[model samples]
Target: NQIHSPFWCPTTIETPTKKSEFPVPPCSTPFNHVNSSALSYEAQEVRRCLRQGLIESPEMSHAESLVLAELEDKLRAAVGTRYPQDD
Candidate 1:
C-alpha cells in the first residue's frame, strides 16, 4: 500500500497586496489586512449583510456574526482603526 498527499506551488509568485496577499498573521481571516474603504464594493456589501443580520439560511448563525465582527476588528487593527460607515 502507498499513501500520498496532494501539494502544489505556482510557477509565478506574485507579491501580496493587503487585498490579495497571504496574511502576516496566518490564523487571521481574509480581509483582515485590508482597508474598509479600500475594499471592493462587493466586500463592503458582504460586510454590511453580515452585520445587519440578513443571513438567509438557518445554516448560518449569529456566531458567524461574531466571526465577521472579529474579522472586522483585525482588519481595523491592520488599517489604523477605521469603520467604513464612519466615512
Candidate 2:
C-alpha cells in the first residue's frame, strides 16, 4: 500500500482574495450628462436622451433614437411614441 502526500488535496489550493492589481483608471472626464429640461430646439441634444429601442433595422433605430433624443430635449419629456400622459 502507498500513502499520498497531504499537500495534493483540494483544501491546499489557495483562492485569490485580492482585488485587481492594475485597476481600471477612473474616467478623467466626467460623463457630460445634459439637463434635458432646460434645452430648446436650438439646443438640440439629439444623442443624449435616446433610450435606443429595439428596431428592425439598426439604421432605422439609430435615426429614431436621434429624433427621440432631440424631441425629449426640446419638449423636456418623452415627446413621441404613445406613452401614458400624466393626467
Candidate 3:
C-alpha cells in the first residue's frame, strides 16, 4: 500500500507544449547558486505550480498548504542564518 501526498494529482501533470510559462524573478540573487536544470522532476513541478500561483490559491489542497508552510519556515530559517538579527 503506497501512500502519496494529496497534492499529487496525476491529471495536473502535463508537459508544457509552448514556451516555458514559469517566469524567472527579476532578482535572481537567491537562485544564483542553484541550478534550475538540475532540479528533479518533482521539484520542477512544484516550482511551476508555485510560479502559477496555484500553490497559494484559495483552492489549494491541504497537502499543498502544509508544503507551503514548511517552505515558508525553511525560507525564514535560511534568511535568519544569512543575516542574523540583532536583539
Candidate 4:
C-alpha cells in the first residue's frame, strides 16, 4: 500500500521527465497592467513624500496619509481575491 501525505511527498514517485510535460499558458490581462501601473505610481509618490519630509507640516502629513491609504487599499484589493473573506 502507498502512503498518502497532505504535506511532504517522496521525490521518487511519478514525476515529469520533460519540461514540456506540463505546459503553462501565458497569463496576461489588461487589469494586471493597469494595476501594476497604479501600484508603481503610488510607490513613487510615497517615496517622494518621504524624501520631502512627510511630517514637515499638517498639509504634508494629510497628503502623505492619503497616498498611503490609497496604496494600502489597492494592495488589499489585489490580494483579497486570492483569499477567503473573514467572518
Could you list the CA RMSD of all candidates, in the order they appear? 14.4, 20.5, 12.6, 18.3
lDDT for each residue of candidate 4 in 1-87, tens digit (9 for 90 to 100): 232231122212333452212222233545433223334444666777778877444345677878987787788778874345423
**What lDDT score goes with residue 47 in model 2?**
46
Tell me, by lDDT, which candidate is best.
3
Residue 56 local lDDT, model 3: 46
Model with the higher lDDT, candidate 2 or 3: 3
lDDT for every model?
0.50, 0.40, 0.50, 0.48
Error of 4 at 63 (Å): 9.8
Tens-place lDDT per residue, model 1, 1-87, is 212221121122344432233222233335543333333444666777778887643445678878988887887779897768757
**Which clashing pairs does model 2 show?**
none
| Higher-ranked by TM-score: 1 or 2 | 1
CA lDDT for candidate 2: 0.40
Q: Could you give candidate 3's per-residue lDDT for residues 4-85 as a string of tens digits? A: 2222322132344532233223444454343343335556667777888784444557788799977877886878744344
In each prediction, how many residue pairs overlap at the backbone (N, C-alpha, C within less than 3 A)? 0, 0, 0, 0
Q: After superposition, how far is residue 70 of candidate 4 from its true place, in Å?
A: 12
lDDT of 4 at 20: 19
Better of 2 and 4 by TM-score: 4
The TM-score of predicted model 4 comes to 0.27
